[model samples]
Target: MKDLLLVLPRLARMIGSLLGDREVPLSAKVALGAVALYLASPIDLIPDFIPFVGYLDDLLLAAIVVDGLLNYVDRSLLLKYWPGGAASLDTAAAVARRLAGWVPSPIKARIFGGRRHTA
Candidate 1:
């Protein structure tokens, strides 16, 4: 819980940067927006009233969005808008990966598709 409290602000800043970045693709922005909406909506896969488990879905969805955006967007562009240093970025990525691990492979594949390669 303490760890999550620390990371959430940084993640929020990163999301803001991504949304403001002109170089980021529309699709990525749209995906992020959807995630935000999902978080804000009263309805959820797991209702917010359920204590710790309630928030898990929101965190998982955020991790999925961040991971997918990292894969889809140019690393250079992402780095450009990232307010944090390389170490911070790496930490954020690691956190996202850890959260994503809780999700099944099939669901990840369905949401993110196959691995994307940059030219």
Candidate 2:
């Protein structure tokens, strides 16, 4: 859990960098934007008042978005903007994978166009 917490900031920085990079495709930017919007919005798939499960949904959605983004964007470009070391990036990816695992495949297909996106 501590390790996962540590990686979240690095993941945020990477997403920020990707959003600003001209090389990143508009589709990816839009997808990232949607994720951000979803996070900030009060209405969630699960209401925030629901305790642990509510926040779990948010984390799962974030992980899914991160994993999906990695599929469309080039790794080299992501590496360029990453402020943390390669190991940190790997750690973030690991966290994403673990969280994403909890999500059902049908939902993933709906979000990622029927393809299983892996980071």
lDDT of the candidates, in the order given: 0.77, 0.76
**Candidate maximizing TM-score:** 2
Pairs that clash in candidate 2: none
lDDT of 2: 0.76
lDDT of candidate 2 over 1-119, digit per residue (tens): 99887777778888898888888776667778988999999989999888898887788889888876655566778788888877877777777777788888676555656543222
Candidate 1 Cα outliers beyond 4 Å, as residue runs:
1-3, 104-119
Model 1: ten consecutive residues of lowest lDDT: 110-119
Worst 10 residues of 2 by lDDT: 110-119
lDDT of 1 by residue, 1-119 (tens): 57666767877887898788777677677878989999999999999899999988998998988877677677777677677777777777787888888887676555545455342
RMSD of each: 2.3, 3.1
